[model samples]
Target: MDYDDAYANVPHIPDGESYPPRWAAEAAAFREARATDRNDLGVSYGDTPRQAYDLFRPETAPKGTLVFVHGGYWLRFDRSYWSHLATGALARGWSVAMPSYDLCPDVRIAGITTQVARAIQNIAESEPGPLTLAGHSAGGHLVSRMIQPGLLPIDVTDRITTITPISPVSDLRPLLHTAMNAQFQLTEDTATAESPALMTERLDIPTHIWVGADERPVFLDQARWQADAWSCPLRIDKGRHHFDIIDALKDPVSPLMRDILG
Candidate 1:
């Protein structure tokens, strides 16, 4: 089925290789420009080095907290590459937390899921008010997993107001045939267990599935699978591909931000 090519995003997007460096540079500049008090860097959520998260606070009292998880197919990228994404939420008076979890090959997808859960629990402890979660790609899968029963503490789950999984991999069974599965080491059992689309019950949290209209057909299908499974609203952002779809997170007034923050 050429699952690898089906899931591949970079080659399909024009000049996609350039996006990472640009994201890193922009994120660095954002960190440098932000007030020291507003940005809390390298806050530990777990013992491992990559287990920490970057917490960005707003100028006035926060209305709530939004935790954003980055997607590198569970292989590449970290919290640093996404610090700038917090701008929109911060501007809207919401504290934003971006966490970096250990990637695949170093740990299984399930382990990465556990790390994110701990990171969210850690963030919720200090940040009060309602909570909203948003994740991209592999991260979208992780955030969706959070709504599963008993995955997070009851208190934390109760505070969750909404979740938006952008271009999420709702079903993992397709990846079993991919070459990357060698690194992922996902068994049929594990793949089904990790698939958010397979769940019949959720935590009653409001969920919205988002995907780029211009994304590869598989991604669009994955998004639709999730929306159908959860019976939730799905939004297709016109003219956006996978890489650029997340750019709206930088704008407070953008539909994505308004949907998540409001």
Candidate 2:
């Protein structure tokens, strides 16, 4: 389906619920599991302690590392609830890392992105090996920011073999016109400067862009746009929405997850 068709399928945001119920439940379960296994590390971003990340690894074996950045439209969510995302990768011998950063409005999107970059650098320093990076929603945007050529310090960027940004906000211009402005407070210039779509940048590592069949039209459009610009793989998960699509990652064998990890 085209981006428009994919977008028209998105469910309307209800008055009280921001994210879907299943996603909230899954995030809650992931956080609960992390309470026992969480390992916190402090990473510095300009002498402040606000930047840090949590590492979750399988007890017996590991094949590679997958670093996930949680998304809340650049405003909400954190690394804690995201440890559950490691489940599928752990079963497949991949360790998982999730980083927390200050939200936007309080901190500009640019600052938040930079902090995430520092988080990746710190994680890679401690665990050196083949790595795959993935992010969802705004986190997906952060992943793109993390891998932007010449942006990352050498050591971390060199280790990434593949990147998968699921339902990323590659373009921020449209968001400025939407209700998301409540938190993003995106100026046209800031949106344009921050968007990967307008940046004309590419990563040497293989990149895959995936969007749910039922994601917001803007999101699907941006995902496809990124794929077209970068000549990367573009995938649409059938019968899925923005939130449900990432749930498939909980199962390593999932077609979406396989494309991501491969």
lDDT of 2 at 194: 85
Clashes of each: 0, 1
Q: What does candidate 1's lDDT look like per residue over 18-76, in tens digits?
A: 99999999999999999999888999999899999999999999999999999998998
Candidate 2 C-alpha lDDT tens digits along 1-262: 4433433323443332645455557666765665454444343433554577767776656677898888877777666556667778877877788788888678889988888887777778777677888999888898887667777877677789888999888888776656657677889998988887677665688888888786676777889887887788889888777776777778978876687677
Q: Any runs in candidate 1 off by more than 4 Å, and if so which?
A: none
Model 2, TM vs. native? 0.85
Lowest summed lDDT over 10 consecutive residues: which window, candidate 1? 199-208
Q: lDDT score, residue 70, model 2?
A: 81
Which residue pairs show backbone clashes in model 2? 63-93
lDDT, candidates in the order shown: 0.94, 0.75
After the best TM-score superposition of candidate 2, give how far the Cα of residue 114 lies from its true spot, in angstroms.
Answer: 0.2
